[model samples]
Target: MMARPPLPLWLQDNLTLRLQDGLLSLPTSSNNSDDKNSSLTTTYNLISKRHVISSLVIPLLRHMRLKKEMSMRSKQNA
Candidate 1:
């Protein structure tokens, strides 16, 4: 099987920059009238960020794992 080429340096840097920007843009705590409301908002933001990160990362991991398994199977068959 042919090996895949690495991503171009500029594209890799762009992806890294975008990921950092995404993380930096996640919601942070803010001042509010009610303590309970503020707490809820903070909690919601945290959960939302977790959900977003997992949603993006989990699929990518699954795809990588699947690719690895397929590669192994191909090698075994060969």
Candidate 2:
């Protein structure tokens, strides 16, 4: 039997981030800013952080939390 190749950590993380980011892409696309006077980017760090936090960090956190809870419950039941 051939062993399946494991995905690289960077690719796995990127895909997970992309999946989370895809959820928010449509809404942001409609109001995208390429204007000369766009203050959102100049005044704050909110834009990029929102994408990173929501797309990457939050999903990972939730996934870990759910896995931990499930394992805890399973141990209790056992």
Candidate 3:
């Protein structure tokens, strides 16, 4: 099987940066009068792509960190 190409450095860095910075919880909105009034009256919609990616990526990165640490410790012990 062909090996998958590595992610571009910027993309990898972006994910890590977002993971560190924390994900957005509130729906983004414009400052326009119409938008403000509508937002106050209507329910805010979640940005599912960002939310889902953040959810999945955070845990995966954490697991990767733990795995790396374990490998380093095992090497030290050896």
Top lDDT hit = 1
Q: Give each model's clash number.
A: 0, 0, 0
The alpha-carbon deviation from the true structure for residue 51 of candidate 3, after best TM-score superposition, in angstroms, is 1.5
List, residue by residue over 4-71, the lDDT tens digit for candidate 3: 98865755776676557544344555667756566643343444445646766676688779999999
What 10-residue stretch in candidate 1 is worst by lDDT?
21-30
* Every model's TM-score: 0.54, 0.47, 0.42
Error of 3 at 22 (Å): 23
Q: Show the colliding residue pairs in model 2.
A: none
User: Over the stretch 19-42, how does candidate 2's per-residue lDDT look in tens digits?
Assistant: 675533433222545665446444
Q: Give the TM-score of candidate 3.
A: 0.42
Q: Can you list the residue pairs that collide in candidate 3?
A: none
* Candidate 2 Cα lDDT to native: 0.63
The Cα RMSD in angstroms, rounded to one decimal, for candidate 2 relative to the true structure is 9.2
Lowest-sum lDDT 10-residue window in model 3: 40-49
Better of 1 and 3 by TM-score: 1
Model 1 residue 57 distance off true place after TM-score fit, in angstroms: 1.1
